[model samples]
Target: METSTFVKEIAERFSVINRLHPTELLLPLLREIAKGSPVSRKTLATVLDWPADRVAAALDQVPSTEYDDDGNIVGYGLTLRETPHTFEIDGQRLYTWCALDVLIFPALLGRSAYVSSRCPTTGEEVSLTVAPDGLHRLEPASAVVSLVRPNASSDIRCSFCCHVHFFASAAAADDWVAQHEGA
Candidate 1:
């Protein structure tokens, strides 16, 4: 693909991914996680001064919530538990569901961030820094990010298998698209 065309497509995809967000009730919890501390359901309940059951019920309403075998909330929304998309800010280490989450979360948290993720096809590590302004120190400056929304019109939910991945090159991303259905 042409350089200009690829840049435009990436910008468009980032817009979509940026708009994908969790519900209002879960936003604070996510921000807390972004700060590097993993919040438990009980902690959230206590912090909000709400009953534990009520907090759990509210969490159930968000599709992004992922629980561990012990039923602890390990991830919610774009946040993951030590995944390939590592988002580091303020000495905190956290994970994101897709590459784009690394790109967008810094702005959401009102702080600068350093993000690292592997190219889905090549497994080459890509790293960059993001501030409210934009990206900087991006290794493989030509690298491209991939965003797939199974349902563009629907609400953002973890159940939806939308993907936000990274690729070292357009050809690499195209190769992945050919192998995956609906990519």
Candidate 2:
């Protein structure tokens, strides 16, 4: 498929998945997490200015909400834990569940991010600087992002995010795509 078409299809899938949950709270929660620390339910409640029970109910609707030992959120799409995708903003290191998150969150956060991830097949590094408007710099200008149509009924992180990745180039993704059932 053409790059634009592929991006649009993937974005549409994400939009559908987002609509299933309380997305209004997502931006504020994401903003708090971007401050470089794990966010507690109480802290999230404070950030949203909602009661703790309400915050918990809302968070329960979000899939793959990772928590630390102390019950703090560490990964929600944007993460504080290390992953294949590294996202850095204002010199603070963060991570994301997938390549798409690297592209999307910079705009949501209204901040530029330096992103680094490896091609799943070739192990070659794909790095870029993304601004709120668009890509600022992309190393190996031939690089491309891989995407999958996820099952909406399943956990989004496992069904979609785990399959999405950055490739050094289209050619580099060929073998990997062939191996994965969907990409």
TM-score of each: 0.74, 0.91
Off by over 4 Å in 2: 1-12
| Tens-place lDDT digits, model 2, residues 115-138 | 999988788899999999999999
lDDT of each candidate versus the true structure: 0.68, 0.88
Q: Which pairs of residues clash in candidate 2, taking residues 3 or more apart in a chain or in different chains?
A: none
Give candidate 1 regions above 4 Å deviation: 1-22, 46-53, 68-70, 78-80, 152-162
Scored by Cα lDDT, where does model 1 land?
0.68
Counting clashing residue pairs in each candidate, in order, gives: 0, 0
